[model samples]
Target: MLMDAFVDILRTIIWPLAIVWVSYIFRNELRGLLNRLSLFKYKDLEAKFEKELLEVEKEAKEAEKLLDRSLPHIADNEQEKIEQLLRIAGISPRAAIMEAWREVECALNDVAKQEGIRVKGLVGNSLSADKLAQIRGIPRENTDIYTRLKYLRNQAAHVPDYVIEEREARRYVQLAIHLAGVFRLKPNE
Candidate 1:
């Protein structure tokens, strides 16, 4: 009775699974046969799949660009905090603004180091020249954060008239947030 039951169980489960396996092994042939029966055209179906795949790729690229544009906004809170500190220190409005630019530059250089990015003509407190090949995956960018930061540091010793654009500020904020991820930071906490 036990052997009979085992065989019955095999008949119900194993046989079906074996048939499924065989069908799957010949799935392409079966699909071609079905297509030839005028049920559907494989070429049209394949083209539809390909078109959908291309659309998906296009959407992914757009999303990546949007994310890139959004990244620079991550440093806003930090900029606010730093500005408040400068204000509390009794610095002039212009001086406080320049200090904010310095923070951004510092953040960018620091982030580059964290990501192992190599930058050229890296004057002042910027990412060093030895970091390029390791992080070629990172895009080459020229943000005001880098230029203004270096400029501010240069002019900081003399006149405090360094100016940073609003766009640069936003970009640096995004960079700070991106770098934070590499270092395993949990946002502003």
Candidate 2:
């Protein structure tokens, strides 16, 4: 009777123990697989982000063309800064995008300062692109594009695990440069 009881107990516990042992043995591999799956799952989100960026880029190009007059040349120093950001994109795309957006913010802050708007600190206050646009009499379409760029920047900033491709980062930096140029224009220009 004891022998039969022991056999029954072994059968009940054996499969569960084997599964636990196997899981422990391949834990690191399983973790890596799950991480890859997480990235794959977010691929749709990445695609949508890229599509929005492309639309904003197109809008920025159209707006630039509509200006008719040439944009004021971006200074050599500014060009160097942009190039540095592009190089950074190769190492860390998220950091490059964030820095590019900071360039846009700095340009907006400069405009705000030009208009006698108080800028509080080094990084400056939270003066938005739309507010600066309205104050500077920028066209509504251009303002919309700037707002969308800010929106994309916010997404990149907030989503910790969001992956930005280097090319996408480059596109974002280019669009930011264009918008910053527009904001730097004289109020009547």
Winning model by lDDT: 2
Candidates in order: C-alpha RMSD to true structure = 22.0, 6.5
Q: 19, model 2: CA deviation in Å? A: 23
For candidate 1, lDDT tens digit of each residue in 1-189? Answer: 999999999889997899899999999998877655642443453354344334433543443453333334435776566456445335343344345444444544565565656545322343431233124332323222233334433443343223333433333333333332322221232
- TM-score of each candidate structure, all chains considered together: 0.31, 0.72
Error of 2 at 149 (Å): 1.3
Give the per-residue lDDT digits (tens) of candidate 2, residues 1-189.
999999999999999999999999999999988876775656876898899998997887787776645677789998999899999989898889889888877888788788887767533233466677777766666777877887888878886667789999988988888878887888666
Query: How many residue pairs clash in model 2?
Result: 0
Candidate closest to the true structure, highest TM-score: 2
Superposed Cα deviation of residue 51, candidate 2 (Å): 0.4
Q: Write down the TM-score for model 2.
A: 0.72
